[model samples]
Target: MKQATRLMALAALMIGASTAAGCGTSAPVDATGLRRVVGTDLIGARGATAADQRKIDRTAVGLCAGGVWSKDECERHGEGAR
Candidate 1:
């Protein structure tokens, strides 16, 4: 009975931690999904080259145009080169 109670407590703690992790300000774009869409490893980070940045911007604008993402979200995700 004691072991069962401990297991239950551990399960509850794990659930709470996972829930909390999803509650914060998360990235607008899923990196893996974006990579798939862009077909490149370049993430348009602060250090990205101009060409890479342009590619990222084009993808973001396409996402926005297609209603896959909002303008604000695109901007927040650092893909808004406009």
Candidate 2:
């Protein structure tokens, strides 16, 4: 009975560790998705010239891909971009 309890505890510990590790990893960024977001934002704004739009796109990409924003924020914007 003691050995069975020990085995169960060990299994539980392994499962917990794996779950924690998975939570720490994030999904890869979708570049096209992010670009679409920047495009949408630029379109929604009034009086943004082509030059201004280009600049905004560059800045958005930098922010999302340069590790300035969290993965969740990037993903949120990516979804919006689409």
Candidate 3:
């Protein structure tokens, strides 16, 4: 009975160690990868609201006006991919 308990404990520890080794934190997402217009803007770090379309539009215009990211990069990634 003691030996069986010890084996079970050892198995549990191995399983936990293996799982930890395989686990990883996911990378942050890029907004331009979004497929829908709904994702065009955001609010308070979440996402855009339909009621705030005009506000979002203005924000988008301001952002797009500067053209921070080069058009060449956008074309390389097939456009709208950030």
What would the TM-scores of all predictions be?
0.36, 0.31, 0.30
Would you list the rank order by lDDT, best first? 1, 2, 3
lDDT of 1 by residue, 1-82 (tens): 4323323433454356445545767734434543344343233333235564555455555555655556786666553323
Which parts of model 3 are misplaced by more than 4 Å? 25-82
Which of candidates 2 and 3 is the stronger one according to TM-score? 2
Clashes of each: 0, 2, 0
Each prediction's Cα RMSD?
A: 17.1, 20.8, 21.0
* Every candidate's lDDT: 0.47, 0.46, 0.38
Judged by lDDT, which candidate is best? 1
For residues 11-69, write the lDDT of model 2, one tens digit per residue. 45435634554564685444464344333343332223555445444544655665655
TM-score, candidate number 3: 0.30
List candidate 2 stretches off by more than 4 Å: 1-47
User: Model 1 compared with the native: what TM-score?
Assistant: 0.36
Off by over 4 Å in 1: 1-47, 77-82
